[model samples]
Target: MRRLMICSFLLVLAATANAAQPIRLGLNYPSTGNYKSEGLELRRGALLAIETLNRQGGVLGRPLELISRNTAAREEKARANIEKFAAEGATMAFGGATSEEAIAAGQRARELGLLFFPTLGYANAITGHDGQRYLFRETNSAWMSARVLGEYLSWHLPNRRYHYVSLDDNWGHSMEQALREATRSRDRARHGFSRISARGARHEEYLAALKKAASSDADVLVIVLLGQDLVQTMRLAHDLKLDQRMQIIVPNLTGSIVEQAGPQVMEHVIGTAAWTWRVPALVKSEQGQAFVDAYIAQHQRYPDSTAASAYAIVQQWAAAANRTGSLHSEKIIKALEDHRYSLLKDEQYWRSFDHQNVQSIYAVRVRSRSEIMQDRFKQDYFNIIHRMDGEAAAPNLDEWQEERGDELSLR
Candidate 1:
């Protein structure tokens, strides 16, 4: 009997030891779909963060593991993935290529009591009306991007006619609305607008959108589509000679998108980014530069804003977890809220009211094909025409409250 008791105690100790293993960091993102390339970048950057953190002995003396589920950029898939992550013992979860995915996944995460940090969701509603205690957005909102881009438009291209070809999704609508408000072109009739499905859009649907925009006689064409869809549509736009007739603006631009669509296609396109690889040197951030170096060493390419966001998500979460020395979601959320951080860029912080990461945003114009090809990797993508501070661009307290529609004292 004594011998049997000793064996049971040893077994229980072994089980406890197994339970003390590394914390699982869940990544629910699209692995297949229009945003597959973006999803790959999220995983790549997160892996690099995990490697660096493990090398440094990890957070709170525990190693970290990345567990991801493919969302295919679908809302239902994202919600289901979050539930799976929670059931699989994920301490926290983060990943979303689109604002729709982020918003849906974040809501589900809240229901499951998991802390979620979105890697690349840009709609204001992610941290606005749809936001909750469980969600923390890492990217700037469409309003913020619109604010910076609008300033340049106001000065350079006042009174220009505009046409908007946006995706029929949360992000697309948010960006289109924000840009319209920014440029003071609220009349959809005066500024022609067209929208295609975010996923599974037919070839003719894209061609039809461009043909309509071309016939509208607009001086500026704002293209809010993304990923493979953007690449396909840009080629169609070129075929329709829309690129030559209308100046193009693509919000939330990334180097990956530019790289996928050759420099000739993306040439002269204007956009905004939270962090381009060149931003590190532009901002004189050594840590950011180191991350760039490490990323290049492994991937042989410049890290785009999406990748930077994924990296920042991992590092920031680990820091918060370490600070609290507990894996409880509430404690970590409180630790991250209103915390100032400087990583791949200059000073940035999580806003207390909405949990949006506030930082500088840039107005970037794609370099000409000739200028881009002159680079070593031919990845010279943007010339920063202007920069705007986060504080100046993000929604003020009144605006946030109006959007949130709640009466709660500042947390």
Candidate 2:
């Protein structure tokens, strides 16, 4: 409990007059719609963090509290939620299942004088072209995932034809483009493309897309879908026997998604994650392990990357708030920018330029059904194949400058 409460974010929390009061933290997540799995994880993680913090002592001597709003994976809903949070006196709000939603939330939070931390959104634009002073992305970007996954694919698959079934949203666009550039699949004719609706697609829609992919001569099927959408599509792909015909590539993978789709559907699938439940053990992170233990004790299962991200955001933000002894955007931002610490997996840092928390990206492969079933909880899914350091995996200054253009300047 002490390990969980006393994280790297706040080494010492100063006492205050209104210490008995509670500090509200807002969360904008998709509790309904396609990304509900991720949303539940966020809620579970946030609650856990709040419980732990309150158990010992909340940040700045005030109890941390979560005030969440359901975005349902929509940008408009996300924007509205931020407005509500600000009106409700939430000092900070963080959460978003999609990049578009995150961008909307963050922008609105900036206007409302509330800092926004996006926990799961992965578009390059979230921290690049669309970045604002009040927003910080706690997750890895599309470019970071592509950088490592592409390197592995180059050595393993090499010169392969591809087909992309992408979510028609901000995250999907950046992911596909980044992966294409990294893998040298710039030629349109060489690879097939099918854009699926970001909102839950109908059965017929998925059937049409997967059938086209099934007929294509592509050696790999890149799925840029997540949550329930991913579960439904993978089941459809399996029914069509597409999994056996070609290798499947999901840009991002979480234990929640795999558990929903089952081990058989996700078996041998390739992807990347910022942190997995198994990662803490691999990196010898006692704090991370304590988090995992607490989660398992409460939920009777292992926590996924979404949960890990949410917990990190809550703890880190609280720590920063305590460090500056204020919830004002300017002070908290200064405390977090260029902040470095070992959390969850490895040495991760909040970069000043783009406000992205850079960390190691692990290229993972789903274990076989037999192997997965052998586990007591059946959540030991990912086999970490390749680990890329944050410094190398993330985009360089030149790339950031190109994306931000005149909106950014050298310090």
Candidate 3:
């Protein structure tokens, strides 16, 4: 009897050891640079998703473990991180805070034949010009935001002349081009524009750009900047009285920006976001409410757009893998493409043609302190003005691919 008991104990120990081995998922984001706040929120969201999945039996009965690395918004660093993740036996990876880094990582991912999911990068090239079979985007593109917002602005403020001031980067250029194309057909849409490189630019340069936009005859000034640069530009624009002179619009607005810039600075500013915590549709949904509640309960703060997006992406990936009952990249990819999931306020699906997640885009107007205090969502600030359907918002994938056939080729 004693020998039999000892053998049973040894067998149990072996099973426990095998069960303890987790399937690693690599994550690289800008954890220590200018975009650290966004990165931290992303990590929090992804971690929360993993935790939830683990608590619910995990994917394919194997625990999912996150292996994180700080890319500092650098391309080479992101590339190295992907290689390290592959070397460390990570089955799949997610990250890329900036489009440049995301593109670099996508190239490396294809070379390594590793599945890569970009969470927050908005450059069209990731899924357009530089897309690979291994790369899938879980975030909205600059073109989507621009198309939706541009069409709305052209119709709503048809007579209002427009000018643009954007950061001189891949994202900024893509946004500018998208908006331009969307509004070009409208009467009185043409206006002067200025682009400033976010890197190594002097104060005078920023001031000059602001002054140039301020001096333009346009009534609406579209500022295509992100992170600290967006905040800095807003502050200087206020100082130069540019904000007061022209109606300022930010194409890519996030909750963190409103918190960082304060309600006062954001007051009267109009913008569009990929997602916001205050959407009435989201607040009313069962899944969305649970996610918000769990996030606030765990993090002691509301999840921003970045956090929500990252969380959704992780959950989507896990669900797809579980549905397919396989961790193989090809199987997972098949499960994701054309897969419909309801993680947010609206039902979303992965478009097979472009690998872009299709969901509603919100146009928001930042409310003043008085307005926010009186609202039902007292903690939330923005009033969602419009919700654009994802299909209408997305660019024509067929045309886009045909125009850039060679560019989109994996070879």
Candidate 4:
């Protein structure tokens, strides 16, 4: 009888200990799709952060573990992934390589009442009309990118005629609208506009479409494509000698693109990035240098903007959970909203109203091969044109709310 009681007590203790095991962090990214490279980078960044946090004894006496799924960049797949995460007892979830997937994940997050951080989904609606208290965006929105890029364009090439080659999607439309609004006062005339399908279009099709846009008499050609499409467009432009015809402005640029395209193809391209591995201000900072070094040591390549954002998101969430002393959704949300931390360049915080992380936006110009090779930092492939303040770069959500009236539902 004594042995039986002792065994029962020990079993209960073991069960309780097992129940208090590591906190599971869920990630849903398209591991096998058009955005696979970006998704892999996101995973790498998140894993690196988790590894570092665990090495430091993790947060609140609990080590962190990551459980990831492939979303395939599909909305339904994203929703299903979110449900799976919730079912798997994830403390919090983060992912969404594309805006469409992010938006879908955001909607599901609201339904699940789980804390979600969407990394590298630049659509404004993720935090705009589709925003819920459970959803927080860790990437720059279309409006933010447009505002910064527009201001730069107006200042540098004012009164120039412009042509637009945009992707036929919500993100592309949002970017186009924001750019039009931002450059309204400038003496600009739309010389031409072409919308390309983002869903697996042939390279020859894109090349032909771009050739038409490049044939325009505009002083600048704005390419609003992402991922391999952007790479293909730039390469096609180079092949067609479009780069020599007019200034190419890529509103939504990332370090991965610059790396993939190389300095020769990317030379003289002006763009805005939420974050970049080569930003001098970031590289010079102690925290930034540590992140870059750690990322390189782990992955053997410098981290891109998406990777940086993913890592920052995980670190920020861990910090918030640690500070609040709980993984509860409400507590984490409150903690994240109130927290201000410096991960990259300047101090950044999640805006209480919209839950968008207000961080510096880099206006970068891709350097020539010669310039990059001569630079001290191997990743210094960009000439930092300007560091747009986070607050200034972000659109006025209050005004946006006022404009939307009752349509804007954030809760």
Top lDDT prediction, candidate number: 2
* lDDT values for all models: 0.88, 0.89, 0.80, 0.81
State the local distance difference test value for candidate 4: 0.81
User: Cα deviation in Å at residue 289, candidate 1?
Assistant: 0.7
Candidate 3 residue-wise lDDT, 1-411, digit = tens:
999999999999998886778989889888886678788988998899999999999888889999999998888999999999999998888887888888898788777877888876888887888777788887888878877777778878776777888888888888878877776723434577788885756677778888888777888888888877787788888787776778888988877787777777777788887777755355477788788889989977778888888788788888888888888888988898888877756777887877878888887888887876675545476778777888888767676677477664434
Local error of candidate 2 at residue 120 (angstroms): 2.0
Question: Which segments of model 3 are wrong by more than 4 Å?
Answer: 1-16, 185-190, 280-283, 373-379, 406-411
Ten residues in sequence with the least summed lDDT for candidate 4: 183-192
What lDDT score goes with residue 315 in model 4? 92
> What TM-score would each prediction reach against the true structure?
0.94, 0.94, 0.91, 0.92
Question: After superposition, which runs of candidate 4 have C-alpha atoms over 4 Å from their true positions?
Answer: 1-20, 185-189, 278-284, 374-379
Distance from true position, residue 284, model 3, in Å?
3.9
Model 4, span 1-411: residue lDDT tens: 999999999999997796569899999887886777888888999999999999998888778899999987787898899899999989888898777888888788778888889986887777776777888898888888878877887888888777888888878877877777776633334456788896877887788778777667777888888888888889999988888888998987777777777778989899888776655354467777788889988877778888888898899899988888888889988888846877766688898888888888877788887887776545566667877788898868676596456976567
Off by over 4 Å in 1: 1-20, 406-411
Q: Regarding TM-score, does 3 or 4 come out ahead?
A: 4
Q: How far off is model 3, as Cα RMSD? A: 3.1
- For 109-134, candidate 1 gives per-residue lDDT tens digits of 88888988987788888888887888
Q: What is the lDDT of candidate 2?
A: 0.89
